[model samples]
Target chain A: MLTPARLAQYVLPLMVLGSTQLMASTAVDQQIEQLRARVSAHSVEVNRFEQELLHPVDTRVAVFLTLAGRNGLEVDAVELFIDGQPVASHLYSKRERNALERGGVQQLFTGNLSNGGHEIKAVISVRTAKDQFIRRESVHRFTKSTGTHRLQLALDAHAPDYEPDVTITEWK
Target chain B: MTGLFHSWVSAPAIKIFLLIALFCDPAKATSPTVPEELSEGVVRFALATGDITAALPLQDRLKGDSADYLRGRLLLESGNVQQGLDTLVQVAQGRYHRGEAALMVARHYGAEGDADESRNWYQVAAKNGFGETRQKARFALAELQRHAGRLDAAGKTLAGMDEGYWTAVGYLNLATDFARTDLNPSRALVSLRVALAMCETDTNRERSKELKSRLLVRAGQLAYAHEDYDKAIGFLKKVSLDSYRTPQALYLHGLALSEQGNYRAAMQSWHRAKKYPLAYPGVEDAWLGMGRGYDLAGYLGQAGEAFLAASAAYEGERATLRELEKRIREAGAYKSLVDDARNADLEWFLADSRTLTQPRLAYLLGLIENPVTQRAVARVAELEEMIASLEQQERDLTVFMAALGNKPSSDTQGRSKQLSADQDALTNAVAALSGPNISPAQKRHIRELRDALNASGSVLERLSNVGGGNNQRQPRKRQAERLRKQTQSLLVEVRAVRDEAGKALDRLALEFIEQEDQRMAFALDKTEQQIAHLYEYLALKKLDGGKP
Candidate 1:
C-alpha cells in the first residue's frame, strides 16, 4: 500500500503547502511590523502637537517704565495711572529710595495697552528738607501704534523752594 | 581743528590753486560725497529728549513716509495736535507705517474724548497692524466699549483675545465693572475665577490672590444677602485661609451654617473665626454668630453669655443692635446663672477637644475628595498591562526563533569545500605531469586531464552555487516548512491580541474624553443651579425685610 509514487504524491503536496504557508506567515509578520512602526510614528506626532498646543509663542505688547531720578527730594511713594485708572501704586521702601537717590532706574510697570492715544499720570509724594510732605503730579500723552513704548519719569528740583518738578517722557 | 584746516587750505595762493584743481577734476568739484544721513538717529534722539525743535530740521532732511510720520509726531509732541494728525493722516494714506500713523491719529482723537473716531481708527490699526500692535488695538476697542457701558459688547470683545496676563486683567476689570453695577454677580464671580486660574507669574500671583480672596468674600456676601445659605457657605469656604478676608469669610460661613440649622457646625466656624486677632473688624460679627448658633440650638443660657461678651466687645458701636440686646435678655431669663456658667464651660471644653473635620461645602468638594474618575484610570491600567504582556510575548518569540537553528548556508558551504578539494587534487596532478623531462605527448595528455578536472570542478561549483533563488529558497523552504505552522499560529494569536488591545485602547480614550466632557458639563450645570437659587433667595429676602 505504501508504494514510492503514492508516498511522493502525499509528500510533495504537503511540502508545497508548508512552503506557501511559511511565505504567507512571513509576509504577515512583515506587515505587522510595518503597521506598528506607523502607529509609533503617529503617536509621536500627536504628542508633539499636544505639546505645541500647551505652550504657544508669546505675542503681546511690552511696556517698559523706568523712574529716571529723584532730584533733591526724598520721594516717599510713586503711583502710576493710565487713562485716569490707577495701574500701579508703590510706597517706596528704604532700599528703593536709596537706589533712586543714587540715580538708579526703577522699572515702574510693564504691561499691555491698546493701540491708540493713552495718557500716563505719575503722582510723586516726597518729603521736603523741613519734613513737610508734598505730592507732585505729571501727565504724559503718547500714541502706541506699533513697537515698544519706554517711559521715564524724572524729578527736577526747583532751586529756591526745592520743589519736586515731576516730568514724564516717552522714549523712542 | 576746523581753524587749522581752514588756515592750511584757504590761503590766497592755495585757494587759487585748489580752485584750478577742482575745475580740472569736475567729478570731485561737483559731488562732495554726500554726507551720510544721520537724520533718522538724530530725529529719534531728539524725540526721546523731548526736543521738538531739534527734530524739526532732521525731520525735514528725511525723505519718504517715515519723514512725514516723524514730522507729525514732532508736531503732536509740540502741542500742535491738529497739525500733527493732518500730517500723520497723509502718511497713513501711504503703504509704509500706515498702521502706526493710523494708530497715532486714533490716539489723538481718543485724547480729545472722541470715542467714535478713536474706535474707528483702532479698528483700522487692528486690521492692518502686525503682532502686538494688532492685539493692543483690539484690546483698546474693547476698553472703549466697556467705557461706553456696553457690557455685553465688551465681554464679547474680550472673549476674542488670546489667553495672556493682559487678557486676564481685562477679564478682572470687566468683572469689577459688573460687580459695581450689580447686574450679573455670577458673571463677575466666573471672571474672577478665570483670572485666578490664568495668573501664572510671580509678579501677578500676589495681586491675583488678593483679588480672588476679595471677590470670593464679595460673592459670599452677595449670596448671604440673597439668603442662599448653602451657596454663601460654598463661596465663603473657598476664600484662602491666609488672606486678610479670612475672618470675615469665616463669620459669613458661620452665619450661613446657622441659617441652615447646623448650629453645632456654625458654632465651630464662629469659634475658629474668633481665634484670629481680636482687633479685626469681624470679631464682633463672629461673637454674634456664635450667640445666634447657640440660640438656634436651644442652648439659651450659653447664647445669652455669648451675646453679653459680644456686647462688651462692641460697647460704643451698633455692632450689638437693640434687637440683639433684647434677644440676649430673653435668653438670660430662660436659664439660671449657675446652669449658664456650667453649659458655657462645657461648650468651651467640647470645642477645644474637637478634631479637625472634613469641610461640609458642596457636591464639588465631594467630587474633589475622590478625583480618580475611576473608569479612565482602570482602562489605562489595563492598557499598560496588555502592553507589558505583548512585550513579554515578543521576547519569548525571539528566543524560540533563535533556538530553531535554521542555518540554511551549511549545505552550500560543505559543497564549496568539496569542490575546492577536487580542484587542489587536479592542480597537483597537473604539476607532476608538466615536468620539463616529460614527453610532449605526455604533457598534452596531462593538460587535457587537467582541463577536464578544472571544467568538471567549475561546472560542479556553478551547479552547487547557482543563483540565490533555488539555493537560498530550498534551504529557506525547508526551514520555513519546519517553522511555518507553529510560528504562524503564534503570530496570528499575538496579532489578534494586539489588535484587540489597540481597539480597547481607542475605546478607552474616547470614553475618557466623553467622561471629561460630562464632568465639565455637570460642574457648569451645578454652578448655574446655584446661581439660580441665589436669585430666588434674593426675591424671598426682599420679601423678608432684606436682612443680611
Candidate 2:
C-alpha cells in the first residue's frame, strides 16, 4: 500500500505527480548481492549454531583422538564412552590412520553432561610395527563446568623407549 | 538418467525454492551426491555440517553437465563468484540448467552495470529457459528496458506476459516508468487501471489486495494532479478504510471534493480522517484541511475551534515523535520491527500496522513506508532469519556430529578384517621360511612364494609400511578437520559482517525517525499558523461589528 510515489506525494504537496524519484535500479540487485553474502554466512552459521544447540558450551564435553609422536602405533579403531554410555566408535581406514599420523586431530565425540565430575573411557585398537594387534582401554576423570570441556585422547609412542601407550588428558 | 538423478538434486529450482522456503520441509527430496568412488553419506554429512569445502574435492571426481552445475554451485556458495559464474556460463552452453544459468549470469552482469551483457544473457534465458525461469527473465528484461526509458521496448517485452500476478506487476512497473518519465500520462493511467483490474481479479496471491490499494492511491493522485477531481474522488473512495493507504487516500479525496466545490463532502472526508492517529501520513493534513473547510463554509466559530483542535493534535504528536526517535536509536526496536515484518515477504512497507504490538513503532508506520526505510527493514529481517537459521543448523549439526562415529562403515570394517588376515598370512609365511624345522627344499619353495608376494606388495604390506614414499593424497579426516577450522574462521567473519549491517540498519532507522520528527515539527508550525490566521479573521470580523 505504501508505494514510493504515494509516500513521496504525501511528504510534499503540489509536487509534480511523476517527479517522485523511483527506487534506484540497483536496489533489487543490491538486495540480491546482500542475499548471496547472507547465504554464504548462514551456511557457516548453521554449523556453529548446531554446535551450540546440540552441545551447549556449559555442558559440552568433546573427545579428540590425536597421535603424539612418529611411533608405528597404527590405530585400527577407537571407541569412547562417557559415564559408561557408549557415545562414539570408529574403525579407521588406512588413509584416516595416516591422517592421524600426520598430526590431524579427529573429534571422537561431543555430547552434553551434567556439571561436576565425569568419567571418560577410551578403548583403542592399534597395530604395532611388529604386526601385533593390541587393544588398550584407559579411563580419565574430569569435571564439567559452565564451559566447554575438551579431552585429548592421545596414542603416545615417542622417542627413548618408543613404547606405545594410550592416554587421555583433559585440555585446560 | 544417472546424470538426471544427480542434476535434479542440484537443480536451481529445487535449491532456490528451498532457500525461499527456509528449508522448513522436513521431508527433503534432494540430497548431495558424490561419485561412486566417494561415499555419498560422507558428502551428505559434510553438507549437513555446512562443510561445503570438505565436499568440494569430490567435485573433481564428478563429470558431465551435472558435475559442471554442481561445481558452479559449490564455487558460488564458497564465495568464488567469478569462477562460479564462469563455470555456470559453461553449464549454460548445455541443456542441463541452461536457462537457469543464463538468468543467473544476466543478473550478475546486471548487478555489475553491464547492461549490454545483462540484456544479452536475459535474452538467452528467455529463449532457452523453461517455465518460471523464462517468465522471470522476461520480467527482468522488461524492467531493464523500463529503467532505461525504453517504454516501447519495455511494452513489447511485456506484451504477452499476461500470467496473472506477474502481468499485474509488469503493468505496475510500466505505469511507474510512464509516470516517472511523464512521456505519456494517459497511457500511464491506462496501465495503472489495467494493473488495478488485474490485481482485483487475481485470487492466487495474498498480496493482490495490497497492490490493488496501492494502484488506487496512485491513480487517484495522478487524476487529482490532472485536475480530474471526479475521477480522483471515484478512485479514492474505493480505497479500503482498513488499508494503510487510507489516510493519504482520504486526504486526497478531501482535496478532490473541495476542488469540485463540495466543501461539506470534503469536510466530512477530513473529519473521518481525524479519527485516525495524527502520526499517520497526511492525517494531520486532513485535520488542517477540515478546519479550512469549515472556514470556507463560513462556520466561523467551528472553524476557530477546529483550528485549535488541529494545533493541539500537532503539539501532542510532536512529543510522541521525539520518543519514537529515541526508540529508533535502540537496536531492539529494529529487531522488534523485523519480528513484525517476518511474514511481510516482498511487502516490507505494506505490512499491516494494526497487528503491531509496539506503540512507539505503530506511530512510525508512516515513516517505515519510505522505500529506503523499507529496504533497511527488509534487510534486517533477512539478517534475523539468517541468525535463526544458523541456530537451527547448530542444533542439527550437533546431532550429526554425535551420530558420526556411532557405527563403523561396512566397507572399512571389511577392509580392516581383510588386512588382518593378510597380515597373518604374511607373518606365518615369514616364520615358516625362517624356522629350523623346515627342509632346504621346503624353505626354497616358501622363499619362492615369499619373493612372489614381495613382488606384488599386498594391502597388508602397504598398510604396515607407514613411511612408504609414494602416497601423497591428503586424507579425508585431515580435510574435514581443516574445513571445520575454516568454518570457525568464517563464523567470526560472518558475525562481524552481520553486526556491521545491523549497525547500518540502526542508523537508517534513526534517520527515518528523525525525518518524521522534523515533518511533525513542520506540521505543528503549519497548524500554529492556521490558528493565528483563524483568530486574526475572527477579531477582524468582531471589530467590523459582524460578531460580538
Candidate 3:
C-alpha cells in the first residue's frame, strides 16, 4: 500500500475529482447569472405595464352644440362652421325639435385639435309669425387647450327681430 | 141686326176696361218674378237638409257668385276635396265673395295638413274677408299655430278675436296646449275657465260641459300632485258622472280622500268608481290603495284580499321581475360551480362539453387545465403543509424548552468551566501552528495536535452543555425562539396561500357572474320586447274591434 504506484493511483483520482468540482462550480455560477438577468428583465416589463395602467392618453377635443330656447319662432335648419369651414348641417325634424325643446344637446364635432384659438359660427333659418323667413347668424370664439368646448345657440326672445345668440363655454 | 150692335158695344167696353187696368197698376201688370233673396233661401234650405241633389237644381237658379260658392261647398261636403278647392280658389279671386271663398280654401288646406298653405290662405282671408269669415279665418290660423308649437303666436292670434263659440274653442285649445305642452297648469285653468264662461250657445253647451269635466279632472290631478287633497277632492267632485272620464275622476277623488285620512269616504268613492261601465286607468292603484287602507284599519283579512287583487292586476310585471330574479339565482349557482371547477383536481367533473357550455365554466376549466395553475395550486398546498408541519415542530420545541429550568446545577457548572479552559488551550495551539516561523515538520505535528484538540473540544463542549443545566436552558431557549420565528414565517406563508385561494375563487366567480349577467340582460331585454309587442298587438286588436 505504501508503494509509489499505489500512491499515484490514489493521488490521480483526487486531482480529477478536484478539477471536476471546479468545472461544476463555474457552470452553476453562469446559470445563476442567467437567472438574475431574466428576473431583472421581467421586473422591467412589470413596471412598464403598471405605468401604462396608471395613466391613459387623452388627446382629442370635443365640441358640442345645444339649442337653448326657441322664442315662438319655427327653426327649420341650423348649420355649424368651425374655423371658417363647414362642419355640420342639421335640418330639424319634428322629433328633433321636440328633443331640443326638452333640453337635449347635440354633438356638433369631435376630433383632435392642437392647442389654439378657434371660431364657431352657426347659421339658423327661422320662420316668423308674419310668415317671413329670416336667417340669423351668430359667431363665438373659444380657445381649446384641452377637454371639450360647448356652444349654445339660443333664439333670443328679448331681441326685437328674433336674433340668435351664441355663447361659448369650456368644460372644466 | 140687334146682335151685331150689342157685340160692337161689348168690344168697346172691354177695350176701355183693359186700358184702365194696365194704366192703374203698371208695376204688377208684368209676369210675377221671384226675388233673389227667396231664390237664395231655397238653395240654403236644400243644402241644410243635406239633399245635394235637390240643392243642385236650386243652385243653378241662384244668381252671381253665391251659386258657384254653394256648388263648391256641396263638392267639399261630398268629399270631392280637390275639385272643391279648385272651385273655391276660383271664387276666392273674385272680390264679391273673396272672404268666404278664401276662408273655405284655408280650411281645406288645414284639413290636408299643409299648415304653410293654410296659414297663407288664412292670412289672406283675415286681411280681406268680412264679418264672421274674417274672424273664423283668424281663429283657424291661431289653431294651426298652436298645433305647430308656436304657442306665443297662437296666443297673440287668439287675443285679437272677440267672444263667441269659435273664441271659446280657441281658448279651450290654448288651455290644452298650456297644460300638456307648456306645463303651465295655472294658465291652462284660467283659459279653461274663460272658455267655460263663454259657453252660452245651445249647440256648444254639451261640448262645453264635457270640456269642463275634463278640465275638472285635470285640475284635480294637478291639485293632487301639489298635495292639496281637499282642493283636489273638490275639483274631482265637480266632474260630471256621465263623462267618459268619470271613473278616473272618481278614482282620483278616492285617492284625495285617502290622503285626507277619510278612509270610509275613500272606500265609498272607489266602490262607486268600480260600478262605472268604463274601465278606470288607475284601477289597480285604487285596489292597492284599498289594501293599504285596510291594513291601516287593522282589517287583516280584507287587506289580504285587496292585496291579492292588486297582485293579480300587476301579475305581468311581477312575473317578469320574478323571472329576472330567478335568472340571477341560477347565475349564482353557476358561479359556485365555476368556482369549484377552478381547481385542477376537479377537471374530471368538468370534462363533459355540456358542463363547459357556460362561458365562465369554460374559462375556469381552461385555467384549471393549464399546467401553470396546477403548479401554482400544488406549490401553495405544499407551502401550507410545510407551514403546518413547522407549526407542529415549533409547538413541540416550546414544550421541551418550558421543561428546562433557568439555572445550571453545581456539577454541570464545574464541568462547563473545565471545557472552557480546554477550548482556550486548543485555540492557542492552532494560532501558534499558523505562524510564519513554524517548520514544516513542526507544523505537521502541530496540525495533528490541533485536529485532535479540535475533535476533543467539540465533544467536550457538547458534554459540558448537556451536563450544565443553566447553559442547556439557554441553548433550548434559543432553539425555541428560532422555532418560533420559523413558525411565524410559516404562518405568513399559510395566510398568503389562503389569500391567493380566496382571490382565485373571487376571480372565477366574477367571470362566471359577468357571463351570467349578460345572458340575463339579453333574456330580460327579450322579455321586455315581448311585453311591448304584446301591448302593441292588444292595442291593434282593440282598434280592430277585438277585446284588448
How would you order the candidates by lDDT, starting with the best?
2, 3, 1
Whole-model Cα lDDT of every candidate shown, in order: 0.52, 0.63, 0.54
Which prediction has more favorable lDDT, 1 or 2?
2
Candidate 3 residue lDDT tens string, A1-172: 0222222222222231121111122232233233323322332332222112111111134444455565655667888777887766766544455455444344444333334568877887877645678887878777653222334444543456654555555553
* TM-score computed on alpha carbons, candidate 1: 0.31
Candidate 3 error regions (>4 Å): A1-172, B1-46, B49-51, B79-83, B93-99, B127-136, B180-184, B200-203, B278-284, B307-548
Going through the candidates in order, their DockQ values are 0.01, 0.03, 0.01
Model 3: per-residue Cα lDDT over B40-151, one tens digit each? 5434543453323323334446776576787677666544566678888988887567888888887666544566787888898998887668877877878777767898
RMSD of 3: 50.8
Candidate 1 docking band: incorrect
Instruction: Tell me how far the alpha carbon of residue B290 in candidate 1 is from the true structure, in angstroms, after superposition.
Output: 4.0
How closely does chain A match the true chain A in each prediction, as TM-score? Answer: 0.60, 0.72, 0.56
Sorted on TM-score, best first, the list reads: 2, 3, 1
lDDT of 2: 0.63
Q: Name every residue pair that clashes in candidate 1.
A: A117-B107
Instruction: Assess the local accuracy of residue B511 in candidate 1 as a C-alpha lDDT between 0 and 100.
Output: 42
Number of the top-ranking candidate, with lDDT as the measure: 2
Candidate 2 residue lDDT tens string, A75-156: 8888888788777778775556656775556656656565667898888888887767888889888876545577777788
